[model samples]
Target: MEAWLLLLACLLIPFVVLLIAQRGAGKTKNGSRIPPGPLALPVLGSLLWLRHSSADLEPLLTRLFARHGPVVSLRAGSRLSIYVADRRVAHAALVERGAALADRPPATRALLGESDNTISRANYGPAWRLLRRNLVSETLHPSRVRLFAPARSWVRGVLADKLLRESEQAPPRGVMVVEAFRYAMFCLLVLMCFGERLDEAAVRAIGAAQRDWLMYVARKTSVFLFWPAVTKHLFRGRLKTGFALRRRQKELFLPLIEARRARKDRISRGAGAAAALKADTTFEHSYVDTLLDIKLPDEGGRALTDDEMANLCSEFLTAGTDTTTTALQWIMAELVKNPRIQENLYNEIKATTSGPEEVTEEEVNKMPYLKAVVLEGLRKHPPGHFVLAHKAAEDIEISGYLFPKGATVNFMIADMGRDEREWQKPTEFVPERFLPGGDGEGVDVTGSREIRMMPFGVGRRICAGLGIAMLHLEYFVAVLVKEFEWKEVPGDEVDLAEKTEFTIVMAKPLRARLVPRSRN
Candidate 1:
């Protein structure tokens, strides 16, 4: 009996040793290593390791990268969350193996109502291709973007009047520029969407309704991330609020969308010439009209329902406004803090423009320094720190590491732009880096083959609105700089501390004295 027991123990000991070794290395049953990360606690997984909500993850992600190197994994319950902070690796995997990293996380898509619609959240398939192509080709194509030139020019005058009214008060207090930025962007997008320049009250109502929905999305809707089957009981109230917010958006947007549809219908019924004369709004083309016309080949050849149309319009408005506001705030703040850079930019604008008579949209292209400043602002403070999470379509290998299928992938946009290895004085704000003979002179924002800095993400999922976004930023910043000196308030210093909302915004809203240089 003793001899048999001893032989059994010796055999079992080696197998136990192998199991222990693999577990120590964090290897899966298939002997694949998920990237190095903090050990997960049972049930909670790595939730305890996180210091804040997922939206505001810059600080938490920064620490994780430092501890575990560029590629790290965090287990969110049963889901594996993988983060890639290194830009070189990001380009190699996301750009080269775009298909593998193209699909979105299942949970995120379902939660965002993008499961089968919306270009940003649609899965990788025929529907996605159709929606993306429509968005890029029909809605925001280069030619269509030029059609909004009148709207953009109008917004500049509105913004200037706002800054003047806010600053011309007693003693020139800090004029909170956040609202102005948001309003201007909302006006521009609303006009592009409905082909109408609405009054201030109507625009504000639309902005407010959209903001309510965005607030629920960014703040109150955490339970959606969990498996709904399990959290349904707990999250019922929040989900109801989410629905109510959706109804509010439909209430506001349905009217605008319906008006567009009515006009389109009249034209389709052979009243085309007469309808054009009677129409209250005239857009060379409206995005809503484009949405109304889409026939989804994947969804049994159905046109978008009124609800879906509302959601898309909401998405169009929210996507354009919040981000532009954030970028404008940052650019204006930097200009306020660094007057010397502003002066140089102003001088460049003056040199480029023919005496600065409101600086027409066509002339904006000639101002390189203004473009450089906008690009630098985007690089330093990208609207989104991480691209919307990408999911691996299959078990993929990159640089000797395994990224398993069904895993969520994210890249650190802020970290990539600020990588000390790639940028000189990475923390400082300098627009010249993107100018001629400068550090980032020819750096490509698009990661076609290589990614230097992606303020708008790269890969097939790169922002469809990239061209319009750049034009909007460049045009607005140039108009503002030409109109105002944008000086820091008396005894109040400029603060660039970041706070995450829908986008990364200044913790203290940008407030400065707007000294008019030229009247629009």
Candidate 2:
């Protein structure tokens, strides 16, 4: 069945919207570290109180800090959850005790697949360490990322073309191109993963199917996280549907995997036909190459299972696409609402691109204003409200607080972004704050210096795609501004309110009117 076919089965997919646990859902444990929170329920835990919005989680986390304290613990039935809002606490756990706290929470096992210790979902283990090392050295290395330039450019062209088509006969209010952003991101990631470019229609079909599968998995899997047996029996239909969705993913991906393997074989034979393969700009480079090339330690000196490769491939595309696209939407909305800042940024781009060749990688690295704009946006609206949950690998103490070994620890990415002590006028959208000589300026976002804001996370499990994400953001933002002048449609003010899924995104899709600037 088509992935979209399952869209009508939300009734069966009750797990999608309901399993999310609220930040302050339950009562606090009487002893041990952290502060206080709401009361918990049996089995369902504090998740019963969570609303539909993940974007709302961050603001709620901020509010909870005010009401309770910086560090608060909540009881979700038998599970004890702690929310660390203070920078010091965050630094203590994520940085100071980095290795000891690098394990992913055990709750992630269901979707993380069997054993759950791989990149992203994997816990701290020999396998995870090997996976992370292999990924950094092989697939996501700076050199490998450089090979993706053509992919980025292709998607950007598609994005610009789509915007142009939408604006051709504008009826006044800026066209709402929110879905365009998602599609572009999906296309880029798809090409990156499959290493082969598809026609626009194929790209759209793949993107739509992927989105459907993701939405379903994200929503339904929450149930399995907290209450295993009861949810399994109660939501049997959802479970079946989930299985069907996974099968659908296999249908879409398995073929691509097979084709890539065939292509690799052809090239290995020194076939002249393989030489006819189109330019780097045309044919997509499969991420599978990296996976196929790297030998995992798990196969007992043999190759990894198809399932493991699938998980890694899916994760590479899904993680980067959703979060980056969501961040793109938020950043564009910020530009639309703040035109002066947009113009200033445009001027910076104009200066860099005043000559002939398109903005080079080196040139992009030099744009302080553009860098600040992205940093500010990331700080204001982090992709994930909190980094993926980190577990205490060993009992550790920091700043008089003790986090027991194996405790699931979460840091507030949004709270740190808006921390009043770290950022001056934290609520305002002041890109200048990140500029030289400004408050919070000169702060390193690389997480090497304490944890103030971590959108991609910190320490051992920090996003492997961090470099690629930054390149895409800066490149697209620069090209986007150069291509058209963005404005806020009068009736529709850009709403900064956030919504949640895997990533914290704008509740309402961004709708903006694009007027092309004189290219001359």
Best by TM-score: 1
User: How many clashes in each structure?
Assistant: 0, 20
Say what the RMSD of model 2 is: 8.9
Model 1 RMSD in angstroms: 4.9
Q: Give the TM-score comparing model 1 with the true structure, all chains together.
A: 0.92
* TM-score of every model versus the real structure: 0.92, 0.87
Give the per-residue lDDT of model 2 (tens digit) for 1-520.
Answer: 6676677685445544443343222223533443456644444455535653432445666677788788866544456567788887777777778889887776533643444535887777767877778777765778887877777777878898899888776647677777888888888888878877877787776676667767876676666655565666777788677667666666777777777777777777986544636664335356777666766566566666676777677777787778888888888899999999999998898887757445666778888999888889999988877778878776666555566666678888888888888888998889998877898688767687877788888877788878788888888787778888888888888898876766777888888878877643
lDDT of 2 at 435: 78
lDDT of 2: 0.74
User: Candidate 2: minimum summed lDDT over ten consecutive residues — where?
Assistant: 22-31
> In candidate 2, how many Å is residue 479 off?
0.7
